[model samples]
Target chain A: MSERAKTPLIELHGLTKTYGAGDAAFQALKGIDLTIQQGEFVAIMGPSGSGKSTLMNVLGCLDAPTTGSYRYQGIAVGSLDTDQRSLLRRYALGFVFQGFNLLARTSSLENVELPLLYRGDSRKERHRKAVAALTSVGLATKLDSRPSELSGGQQQRVAIARAIVTEPGTLFADEPTGNLDSVTTRDIMELLTRLNQDRGITVLMVTHDDHVAATARRTVLIKDGLIESDLVRT
Target chain B: MIWNAFSIALREIGRNLTRAFLTVLGIFIGVAAIITMVTLGQGATLAVKAQISNLGNNLLTLRPGTGFGSRAASAGVPSFTQKDAETIGEQISGIAAVAPVRTASQSTIYLDNARACAVTGTTPVYFGINKWRLAEGRFFNDADLRSGAAVCVIGDTVRKELFGGEDPVGARIRIGRASCEVIGLLAAKGQAGMGDQDDTIIMPLSTLRRRLIGKTSSHDINQISISAQDGMDSNALINDITSLMRQRRGLGDNQDDNFNIFDTRQIAETLGATTQLMTMLLAAVAAVSLLVGGIGIMNIMLVSVTERTREIGIRLAIGATAREVLLQFLVEAVTLSGVGGILGIVLAFGLCAGLAHLIQVPFNFNLRINLIAFHFAAAVGVVFGYTPARRAARLDPIDALRHE
Candidate 1:
């Protein structure tokens, strides 16, 4: 417990998010408290309408909580403007989605180099780093392939390569393998487990599938926008 | 961030090549039209002005009576006879020379080869007044006019037309029912508004008077060409001529002068003003095309933003500021317009050359106009490209990522 006080990478307290205004207002998040420490692989699981997606948005820094505060690296992230939030997302969080979100009309190398591009890397440097990132995701031969040219599983791999290319502080993946076949899903889960154990990269994934959630070292269950149970899998 | 956005823009445009080209076409036509119209219009004006100035600074042309447009065929106004020419020569101060002219049209032949040609009857001074230089042989002298000799001087065009490349000097050519000898050949002066100077056959004034018209009149002198001495006041010279004409015509103190005296400078200014107005009108019409081009850019940009929503969301998630996103698409738009503007300049020159040939005006492809229009189109692209780029930049990543 004394070690838990050393400073978690992400700490949120009584966070609440609402949409619209007046009588049409709908609360998407309600009184949520969560902490994610460095080098911790955690999975969030919940049924539909449980506010798991909304919580993921706040956790990923893609949106701001209408109530309470979020501290990133001990700095209050809620105080930052849109630009800094974007910078935090780029430098601190690597995101992988079920849809992959790969840019069309672009190659795998360019996709992986995107985050580094915001870091002011030269074209030559961007190319070298993007190549290295693709290799890490077992896409060494598919650097020039556009998203449409690759299979679904391969495209998802390229997307994962893009997410982890920047070596971000935390990786936030929401249903990263939901769109993959059973074989591809197993391969992706193996990749995530290896990244967590070998690379020691912290991961926060949201998934409803028990098999997918079982790959993470810890799992947190949310019900009605509240954490109903937390468990560690050995 | 800027570079990231730029690549996104470049790739998007590359993906939609057809849309990109269509967007810049508007600017292309606008710029090209502007350049072509202005160049040809200004070139023609310059050519005319240069030719007129080449006629010399000391020259003046006088036409008889109040009628300005009609003069050559029949003297509708009172004729300035030998007596009036002598009087103006003697009384007008700072005057150089006075020559009375009569011109009639006839298609006569020497060797059965007949072509319609102008027969000009004037004194030997007509050669000097009109700055006609002799290419071969001598022009008519006082002896030719005094003797009413049937001798003539042929312009270069008529020399080529009737004489076919032959030296027509010393050759006999029929003029107005009387065969005359071609004593001299005038130098080639190309085409002018009055007609081809080289095509006219100039003869002794006495011969044209007796042979062509065969009638005498005191009220039918077509024109008077005057010249003031160098370093002399043209205004004072005009006043002297005006007063002399008034005295001779027997006008009262309150009566308006029957004849008109015009300044070449005034004609030049009026001509320039008309040309300038034409240039402005043409340029304004062409500018409308440029606006249409900007709309094209806006249209393509809107499509691009819609198509690349996911890309924009990804960039935003990866630390791209709105400014980066904006600049990326904006630069793409500018590049399209800039390339189109360059191509437009080349096309403008081509159109100018073609039109100049059609209208017989000197073609001048000016670089200054091209550069200005190039920059103008580029600016249009940037300004028009901003709204769509800004909108794309400000889109919510959460929403965009979720979009199908």
Candidate 2:
């Protein structure tokens, strides 16, 4: 386990992202070099226009870097084609958005089972895993409730269940608690910390609030497309 | 994977039932209209064939002049004689029977009733040629023709009008100035293309010319009906008859024959072709509606893709491939139109049956056309659904997620 922890799960070197072309171009990430180990809970923090979301997008394999290289478990992500990247994300990565992003008019159970559905799991297997995931998030009783019927915090919990339903190695949360009240944010933070410690699932989150950032074991602060400081609590 | 996509599509459609229903309404109307038109067209064609075949099997009527009308019956044209009919009967190889006909509308009085009826002068062979059956009593015998006896066979309508439910057989009725005894009651032949066949009286040609008309010198006849032997081609017989009449009439080369020969089979075929053309035309119009329905589907699918952008983004983020997303939307469109197609088929059946009964045509349920219509509707779904689905699939997850 110590030897496995020594090998980094994600490694980024001189990564940069630019939007648009020619004179219309605006660089979102000037350069980003970061390494994260397995089973770590890290928070990425930045003010508006600091490119933290861009970094999270690149880390989540949703966007490609314009320059430099990113390696997930020593596999060069820049060399992967769109479909290959999709496959990598399908098997190794999961996501939770600030908006919850659960399909509208769908029940909580079906929303939670969506990732497993994409994984091509059988109906019975999807139901079993989704129920287990929802139960872990304290939403077992709200299985048939739609997002409209659920509170914002409950919807976020459903989103979290969906992310972990496929048992992916890493979870990327972009402002997961941004839409929740402070009390519900604490409850969600507790759930994330428990999942990180108990299941050993690596959780990387982006937040502007220092209070939300305090829940993570490590914090990386970005300003003007560059990491200003990365601090470890322990 | 396909099943999963289909279920997802069905669920999405089920979420907004009214919108989905409105979207597919065009498809429903188009399919139903096409099917009803085709079915009715087939029934009309069948009715035409049945009506024409009622005239007689392999029957050909040779009438005076080029065609039927005032111009054809002008004074310059000469009518056929009984000798012409005899010569054709002897000369034509495939001829089964021939009957010379002379018709005149005359007022006949029986008891206290008087009715204007068609007085037909023909022979015993006319009964066989026209497939006429006797409801009661016997037709004129050879002796009756030889003696020029005033005995007639009354059609069903004539019997009912002149006799009023009383059997007219063996009853004497005065036609023109001569009294004739009704020998046979002809069975009802109903309506044919020309008109009602059951409103005439038939007698021997010799009896009508000698006794009723009071003319023994002129042997002019209005028409000659010829029946070909079974399995004989009417076209060949018509060609032969045309040549014979031309030669007998002594027309010079390059002179068009003044007489017209009407073949019942040819009439049936021409009428059938005309009805089929009409069917095709109506079906083509209905097909345009189907095309419009496809366009409607495309329009709605585009809107649906736009409305569900964030949903697509969520699926993409959760590890759905582009192809999977495309399949989901494609299946939704197909399901929408397919359901519409099924509903259209059901509506078409009801409409076809109801209209057929109302219009007095047969209700023809065509399985092949129904199948083709359904497949075409589904195909329309695929064709129209492709663009919107591709648009959904190609969307950038970040941009789509950001969309409100």
Candidate 3:
């Protein structure tokens, strides 16, 4: 088990993504090679029009790289079909959007249970796990409140509960605190950091703020569809 | 997976109930219209059959013309005499009874009350041939016909109009310039396809010709009604009557007979076929509206798919398969139409019962048609829902998530 844990959780070799065809073709990612280990909290930072978002999509298995290979836990993701990739995401991946993306008019508990529903969990099991997830996010009393009724910070907590309820090994957050205030952003960051430390769940986050990136142990920055630098905090 | 999709669909529909109701309005109207039209049409067909059967069993009528609605054929045709009726009864093998008839419209008066009534002149056999029964008094006897007595039997309608509640039997009523004694009252037959059957008065043939019509000619009889024996085929009886009538009229082998014989059973079959054809035509038209309703479902489902693109993105990102997404939308569409079909069935029953009462036809509750309509509505949902569901399922998650 210790040797298996030493192997990289994610590995990409010469990955590239191109949109459209012929003269109108535009390249989003150009020849990127990267590896992420298990239980790593990494931040991806880039300016507008950089390849950071595309890299995040490819790494999350939401989009396939046009040229080259991507392996998640040594399983070749590039060769898998759309449904197979979906299965991979179902068992191993979770996502949090900048908009919270919680279903409107649904209670927070139901929102957290959405991923488990797709996993075919029983009603009792889903309810128990959803309650535990919400409680871990300090939202034990807001179980029945809908997204519209909750504050922005509370909505993000509900989204985080939904992400973790599936017990996925990796969580991809695309600007999860972009819509929240400074104090609420600090609260969400602390919650994410605590999850990484306690549960050993790897987190890949994309952010424009340096202060947000400072919360992670490692940072990778992109410019003009290419990686510019990779830095490690001691 | 399917059960989950169904619950998700139900939740989505419950979120916007007004929109859901409006979306299914077309299907509701279509189903209701189809059921109402078919139910009423079947009721009318049954009513027609009932009324025709009421005319008589195994009855035939011979008139001095090629057929009805042909005045030109009968223009120079000589009318039949009482001897012709006797020949048919004596020669035909399946004969039950035969009666010679002559009729005229005359102004009848009793005291100060006066009204125009059909005055028919025939023997007592005419009542038995037409299946008319007496409500009061007696029919004409052979002695009354032989002596040309001025006695009459009144129908229910004439008794109601001219006699009010008073009994017309044993009373004298003036017919044209002659006074006739009423001896019997015919029972009510209500309304038939031809018209009111209980609005005429009957007298002996000799009395109508000698006293009322003042026509001394014995060959003035215009109609001969013949009834066949029970369980007898009418076509053979008509052929026998035709041969006998031709032999008596002294017609050549190739010459057409100057008269027409009508089998009542054939008339009933023709009338029944016509009504059934009309019913099918109305039902087909109602089915077209049901198709249009399916198109309405497709249109609304397409709109829903487009509006919920972001929701689809979220589900996909959270590990829902494209098949699951497709199933979700498809279930929603079917649920909407299924509910509409049920509501339409309820509405159709109320409307059909009310309309049947107003038009005086029986209300028929046909379960087979209701079930067929409900199943068809659900099928429409599947056929129209596939395109929109496929569209939603095939959406790119990255692009969908960015959609406004």
Candidate 4:
């Protein structure tokens, strides 16, 4: 409760998202109010058609809400243009998609350096930071290996390295282990948990699996287009 | 930032090297065609100008003909006499040298074998005006012109035909009832557009008038060759000679001069202008292919943008500005076409050299045209690449990520 007095990392007020127009319009989110503090591990869980993905997109700055105010570190995100939003995403945010979207035919080191490259980092800085990130993920020997040459778990690890290469304030993982086998999923979940606890990085993961949600310190459940329950674990 | 984009673009192109090369093939052919045509056309023009200039330096031929394209052999026009030539030589202000000439065919020559050949009769001034060089022995002096000596200078072709690699100097050959000594041999001048200038024999004008034509009444001559001094206005000299001939022939104003004055420089200029026109026409036609090649680049770039939609989405999601993405793809397009331009230049030079050799023309490399073609190809890459790059930049990241 004391966390509410401090400035939050992200805030959404009455956030609403809609698709199409007129009679064909569908509202994906309605009157959503959410807040995330620094160094918090939160999991958003929902069934299909429950608008959880839409909420994640807005939070990640990947999409703009139809009628809402989004603030990142107290700056209004909804007022920003596309390029401005991209700049925010480049500097302050990191995303891990379900499909480990590493550029094909590119070395893992190059994939990890992508975010820093957009920030106009020097080549030497980019290489140093990317190597450190890969080393943190225990993939130092696979720097030159391309995504095609790596296993599914290794590819996801490279994606994680890329996400953290910029030392982003927040990591948004949408079904990061959705394509992995049970063993690989467990290994990835353990890695995510270690990153959140050791580095104190704010992690917001969207998953339907209750077990995956259990690893997060807080669980948010959504039903229909609204948050049904919010629970904090000890 | 630009270096980053450039490196990315180079890597992407390297990833699909074969496709990139194939895509630029049209541009390659287009540039090569334009350069090859222009280079060869210029070479041919230069060759023609060289041949025309080789006919004579500052020379003009006065023949018995009316209007342009009239043959000197055509009847009805009166022939000029030695007295007329002497009058022009003494009266014209810029006349450097003048020679009255008489030509005759069917001269029987015997030098181990006899062959009928065309023989030209002229004074020592003919050698000076025409700039004919002696390969061996000495030319006819003033003594030969005054005494009407039966001495002749054999051309390269006549020497080859009759002498057969042997020195024909001091050898005696018979022309009709006259026996002439071969005092000199003229150097080879190769073939000219008009005819082979090196296939005839040269003798004294007086000797031919007396021995060949048997003109006992007057010193009748076929034509007169005149040379103007360097830096002199030949047109004024030509006008002066025209009025002189008209007055001598007793013709009134507007009677149409019966004699044709052919200036070698003027003929060269006219021929040069015609060849220049031909070169322009060829270049224009070849430029059409460059346009087609530009269209080809546009088509391939569009297809590439569509094919790389997922890649674009990834870039966008990773915080790459739309401008950066656009620049990356544009750089790739430019690299492809720029390489094509280089390859085209190489091919054009090789092809131009081979063709020029085959056709016996000079191979003139036009650096300006090559640079223009190269830069134009790069510009084509930019113009044609803009649409696809914009399309890729404007793509919705969400939709692009969803694209297969």
Query: Per-residue error at A169 for model 4, in Å?
Result: 1.3
Each candidate: RMSD: 3.1, 2.7, 2.8, 2.4
Chain B TM-score, all predictions listed: 0.86, 0.90, 0.91, 0.94
Candidate 2 lDDT over A129-216, as tens digits, reads 9999999999989999999999999999999999998888999999999999999999999999999999999999999999999999
- Residue B263's lDDT within candidate 4 is 95
Each prediction's whole-model lDDT (CA): 0.81, 0.91, 0.90, 0.88
The 10-residue segment with the lowest total lDDT in model 3 chain B: B64-73
User: lDDT per residue, candidate 3, B148-181, as tens digits?
Assistant: 9999999999998889999999999999889999
lDDT, model 3, position B282: 85
Expressed as tens digits, the lDDT of each residue in B37-101 for candidate 4 is 88999898888888887878899999886855734444677788889999999999988999998
Instruction: Name the DockQ score for candidate 2.
Output: 0.69
TM-score of chain A of 2: 0.97
Error of 4 at B364 (Å): 3.6
Residue-wise C-alpha lDDT for candidate 3, range A1-234, written one tens digit per residue: 787787799998999999999999999999888899999999999998898999999999999999988999999989987788888888899898899999988999999988888888998999999999999999999999999999999999999999999989999999988999999999999999999999999999999999999999999998888889989899
What order do candidates take by DockQ, descending? Answer: 2, 1, 3, 4
Give fnat for candidates 1, 2 and onward, in order: 0.77, 0.67, 0.58, 0.52
TM-score of each: 0.91, 0.93, 0.91, 0.94
Cα error, candidate 4, residue A80 (Å)? 0.7
lDDT string, candidate 1, B1-404, tens digits: 45566666676678768877787888888889889878988887876665554454566666566635655332344667667777888888787777776777887686757888878888888787677888999999999999888888988878777878677888898776787888899887766454555778888888887776665775434567776677777677778888888888788999766677765544665676787789878878887788788888888888878977988888887777777777888888888888789888989988999999998878887788788888989998998888988888889989988766
State which candidate has the highest lDDT. Answer: 2
Steric clashes per prediction: 12, 0, 0, 0
Task: Name the candidate, 2 or 3, with the larger DockQ value.
Answer: 2
DockQ, 0 to 1 scale, candidate 4: 0.66
Q: Score the docking of each candidate (DockQ).
A: 0.68, 0.69, 0.67, 0.66
